[model samples]
Target: MKYSIISILLSLITLFFSIKINLETLIDYLSTDGKSQAFHGLIELKYLYKYYFLILSFLSSLFLVFAFKINELKPFKHSAAFILILGIVSVFTAFWKWFI
Candidate 1:
């Protein structure tokens, strides 16, 4: 249950950062659409998600550790359990996008 809450918080934080990065990327892309520069804006965008990958992977690993040691979320618990699954899915989905 705690892991689920933590996961949701982390995921939300990541999402907020993701939106900011995306906006920056969009601006960069538009600003450089016609003019040629020494550094390509798209290149910057390409590597921007690396930090998120590291963050989410580290978080997921930490969740696994604590889940096994302390959480032990049961599948049938319903309320918190459902929240936990939702949190996990959101984290994994964001992580997956950053992954590839």
Candidate 2:
């Protein structure tokens, strides 16, 4: 319960930052002949991080819903299980990145 709340809170924080980041700077980075390639590359990396964070956050919300509906085992249970597993795997993948 507490972990879910903290996860949601952190996901929301990441989402907020993700939405605020500018995409044009990232687009510019992908342009091979751009003047600010180095700086723009850094910005692009941040942009990707922001987007992945947002995706993870989104997935986390789905996992929360799955967790909430875990007991029913009627209609949403299968979906919930699938989502729950997916969430676990995703978090593991994210952890690997963090650790490495």
Candidate 3:
């Protein structure tokens, strides 16, 4: 149960960072000119960081789900479900950016 709570917390952290990086990327993309100068260091970092966070979020969410299932604690089940949904949404958002 403790591990599951920790995993959910980590997932939330990852989600936060992922969203932050995404917003920064969008702002940079919209503000930049047609020049390739925008693809420099920080932009590359943001791109890579977002994916890292997304991956972290997925792993943590998985851990939480597994732990919660093993414990079968009704109290935390709702929270676990919410985090799982959040993780799925984050995964979709991350992939959407890559594909589109």
Q: List candidate 3 stretches off by more than 4 Å.
A: 34-46, 91-100
lDDT for each residue of candidate 1 in 1-100, tens digit (9 for 90 to 100)? 6765565455556555555555555455556645643465445646455365447535844664565567466542233334444444543343322432
lDDT, model 1: 0.51
Error of 2 at 61 (Å): 2.8
Q: Candidate 3 — what's its lDDT?
A: 0.64
- The alpha-carbon lDDT assigned to residue 51 of candidate 2 equals 43
Per-candidate alpha-carbon RMSD to the true structure:
6.5, 9.0, 4.8
Regions of candidate 2 where Cα sits further than 4 Å from its true position: 23-46, 70-100
Best by lDDT: 3
How far is 83's C-alpha from truth in model 1 (Å)?
11
Please say which candidate is ahead in lDDT: 1 or 3: 3
Question: Which lDDT tens digits does candidate 2 get at residues 42-96?
Answer: 5456445444554665666665665465444333444444444444344334232
Q: Which ten residues in a row have the lowest lDDT in candidate 3?
A: 91-100
Top TM-score prediction, candidate number: 3
How many clashes does the backbone of model 1 have?
A: 0
Report residue 86 deviation for candidate 1 (angstroms): 11
Candidate 3: tens digits of C-alpha lDDT, residues 1-100: 7757767677677667656766666666666666754454455554764555666766777777777668856656567667756764764474324632
